[model samples]
Target: MRKVLLILVLCTAMLSAQEKPGESRFLLRGYAHSGVEVRGDETTFVGGSFNPIFLWRQSDKLLFEAELEVEYENGETLIGLEYANMSYIINDYATLRLGKFLLPFGTFAAKLHPAWINRLSSKPLGFGHDGVGPARDLGVELRGGIPLGEAKMTYSVYMINGPALNDGTNPNVEPEEAGMLLYDLGEDNNNNKAIGGRVSFLPLSNSSMEIGFSGLYGKVGNVESKYEDVAALLYAVDFSYVSKVSFLSGVVDIKAQLNGVQVDDASYFNVEDSSNYSFSNKSSAYYVQMSYRPVNMSTDFLNSLEFVGRYSELSFPEGALWTSDQTQYAFGLNYWVDWRTVVKLSYQFADTGAHESEGEEGEASNDAIFLHWAFGF
Candidate 1:
């Protein structure tokens, strides 16, 4: 941890020292949110986050960017390096980036994750930093945009240290539990690397609609006698649409997104007891949201207020080791205090399906309410 901090400090100093005369060399910006929530009759204060982002323009084609997030929760403080990367723009068709950064598998992680940008107070199920999808990775990436007539296309391809696998030795650990190997930021467990990319298309020149496809392939596990290598593959499709419509004698904005992922099964063997194991796992998730605002209201507060509704779900195949399928319904109101600040209140209804074992079943559910204030600069 000390080494990481030292590296960041040294990088910052180097960038500052390289600044040319009369030119601004660095930009600092980030977002934060604080809130209070009630769940199952228990209320608590949400301490929120203090994130600092730095950007250094080394030259016309070279740039450096990094972000550090400090969060407090339940009387404990946690700090994380969200991303740090250097990029070189070779041309309009290709840009290369190196170091740790957010995965380019979907639009949400890179585009809509900031507290001030996202419409909801909470993330969708199976899509958080440690959720089923890949949030970030240490790797090298090639990304660029292409102009095609009146439309456009963008692409990102990368190679990185892939997910880590379980050795399948502990009796309490099932083979299918390997699905939990989504985000491993430490050392690479295996010699192989993962390859992934996403491609997006905008068919209409004047429309805010985009369609995308993403995929990943890699092998998980070490090449040891006790452990068998597992081939991991994932594929996803997503789309987003945004538009303005007239409503209630005012203008309302409509925005929505849908996406899902599929993963292949893995096989392994235990050498200690000559046991063979296989994990058949497949999962998917999706969410849709809509918001309405009365732009022409007489009062400033009423004009700044917006109402929102959303529904999301995450599901897995039956009999899987992790068997709790979840669905959530949420409604909220957001008031824009200014261009960079917002106050939000939301209520969520969550239902988790029953897990069946030997004819017995149990399920869980919750209802929660939250009020939060967010700002960015």
Candidate 2:
């Protein structure tokens, strides 16, 4: 990985030098965020952070993106190439993007590549892998738009295949086998494919609405788990209303999964003998959010604030299902630092159900206050 990254940087530098003076149409963009917080239990003194991002876009034909992060929990270093793709412009109607990129999933997941697309809080809860997998993947996709009488429509379709296991932890072990086995007897079946799509419509010149749906079905059978299958489905609807004086946006996100004869995680998988757990078990999570901004985009500086809030719920039969339901409330304030950046602060409250096991620490009502600085170009 290190050698590959070095080569990428060198290639980007060469591309930059070859361009004529001020004639190069190449683009570069990046973002960084860090937060320090004292949770409801202030004694924890938790601090979380992520390193800066780097990207090189050569006239939209070729692009390279990467990120390096140091986790605060255990202080582990993680680095990966998020995107290194080549794009072909097929006239003005559409563009063909081939290589490692984002899948056409949920609204938030699709827009995660651009830091300024939405508030940072809208992330995390929706995607897996701590919002990383929720972003991009090793895949190929097509994206573009079409014009209508008074409005326009946009769309995306993709076919993706890559490692589903997370970087920091082993995704093979069942949650029930916490510290029992260090390795799996079965072969790693990360070789799988997925398909997804999304579309948006604008009935008026300045206002728009979108509905998206995505599904994945794959077989990851190796020697040990000969018939293990992993699959998932997602759906979402987004509405945005923008006028001269105010802005309102709302979203409904839903997701479900079925893992047959496969070990997903302790909470979602069961591998015990004669358990007969091979049947397709269904699970889901969803959230509804609305945000209203009183200030118009024409404002010079950070001239206004928006009141935003959301409610989310999740359930899993394999996990502590009775105790898995939760509700969260968040309030945010946005300040424009410049044309490409904004500073945001928000607070969240979460309530969980009671744990079924006696050893578990049941449910707890907790609060988290966060401050995030987001920017893009």
Candidate 3:
């Protein structure tokens, strides 16, 4: 508690410090939220996050930025440095960034993840912190945007310390199991670095539509015998559209994303013999969401409300080592108090695909309701 308070004090002091006349030296901003959730037969109180962001303009061409998050969950507190990086603007179409930063693999993870920005309360399936998609890494990156006639194109490329493979005896670990195929942070078990990037295109003028594609490839696993070389690859494509229509009398927003991953030489062919292994790796996931907000409405309350719907799924091939596949459906309503504050209510239904036990087919399912208040400043 003291440490968290001290960090906040330091941030406040930095933001409040006096600066030279006509010189913009620093700025601060962030988003936070808290909520209560009722799931199945249990109800829990949640302390969302106290995320603070700092930015410094050292010179005309140099800038520094960092974000820190303090969160509480399940009677425990956790702190993390979401991103800390420096950027040097080379020109109109190129900027260099070095240090730990968010991965440029997907639009949602890189751009629309802040509590104040995301329309939905929860992340899509297989795209959360430790899900199938890569989140952040430590290294250097190049990114920028370019204007082409009436359209725009943006790109980001990075090379970072890749994920490490789990060579443990147990194959059912939370994240690193054969079925989960999770990646370790801050360390690379092997010497190879992962390389990936995203490219986005805005094809229409005065339109909020973007199309993007991303890919990442690298090798994971220790150099020791029996666990030598496993190659990992990920690919994703996403699109988003926002527009106002006459019939709906509102602004409509739609987003969709699909991603897949493959890990070569993932499992051993012979459980009794470690030397016998095969390369049969496959996994995929996708999500889609739509929302509408009335514009130019007469009443204040009606103008603030928005309706949302979403569906997502994650799957693995049949006969795979792990026996789990998941699908989710969600509906939500958001009321914007201001540009930087919101109240949200949502319900989610989830199903884990059939599992056979004792020659009988059975499925697992869950239902949950959530209420949250979020703000940004």
Candidate 4:
């Protein structure tokens, strides 16, 4: 808490120092959301969050940015740091960044995660908090963009403290988290650092479409431990396309991404007994979404209405004790109050796939409806 206060004071001092021409620039912006959810014979006012982003531009070549998330849950207030990073432009084509930053493994983490920006009330399956893919990390990054004649290309490369795998051997670790990757920041359990990056291309001359590929590789075990040799490899492909169709009299937007994770074969301690076990240690997740809005229509209310649909899936390694194959279908209707504010109503259905002995038909869970209002400031 003291560190956060210090940082805020420094930002304020910097902003106050800009009394002359060619001075620095400071900006405060972020998003917040509040909502209610309804399920089988139950209705509850969902929790909410206030996320504020701070930015300080010291010069044309140097800048700092950070984000904070504050939420109230379980009768307690929780504060979290999303990221805090300083960036320096090295040249026209490259820049250097250091400190905690969101992983660019996919566009979602680094780009489209703000509550006001997401069309649906909830994120896709196996995504967002405690998702299957990597999120933010303390690291050094090199990023830039290039022009390919009429097309464009961009890239990012980074390295950070690698994630640690839970093997159910530690008393403090939960048995349900065994065989899963954990991103506990502050210190490294080993000397190895994770390496990752993302590269994307916009082949369309108008820049209406983009395709991206990203991956990360690292050793995920403690040094000198029996699981030291265990490593992980992950990859993802993502795409976005948006166009204005005259025939439909509306704008069509489509986005999709698929992520795959593979960990080296390893034996893990069975917390239930004095034994060990191993599995494929492979998992994957994906989501496809589309939305339409009659922006060019007649009245303000008519043009502000948007319809969205999404399908997502999560496939966890089945042999693990805490594993399941899950799928989600979501549909939403949004009212755009403005460019940065929206009221959304949505419904989602979750299906849990059966195990080998549970038969073919998976068990379906109760579907629910959500009403949320998101604002970006």
Index of the highest-TM-score prediction? 4
Sort by TM-score, best first: what order?
A: 4, 3, 1, 2
TM-score of each: 0.84, 0.68, 0.87, 0.92
Cα error of candidate 4 at position 21, Å: 3.3
Better of 3 and 4 by TM-score: 4
Where does model 1 exceed 4 Å of error? 1-24, 167-176, 225-228, 247-264, 267-279, 355-362
Error of 2 at 152 (Å): 1.9
Each model's RMSD to truth, in Å?
A: 8.6, 9.9, 8.1, 7.4
Best by lDDT: 4
lDDT of 2 by residue, 307-371 (tens): 56656555433332222444556666666576567667778777765434435442778788767
| Clash count for each candidate, listed in order shown | 0, 2, 0, 0
Indicate whether candidate 1 or candidate 2 has the larger lDDT.
Answer: 1
User: Model 3 residue 327 lDDT?
Assistant: 90
Instruction: TM-score for candidate 3, please give it.
Output: 0.87
Candidates in order have lDDT scores of 0.75, 0.49, 0.80, 0.87
Q: Indicate whether candidate 1 or candidate 2 has the larger TM-score.
A: 1
Please identify which of the two predictions, 1 or 4, would achieve the higher lDDT against the true structure. Answer: 4
Relative to the unseen true structure, what is the C-alpha lDDT of residue 286 in candidate 2, on a scale of 0 to 100? 55
Clashing pairs in 3: none
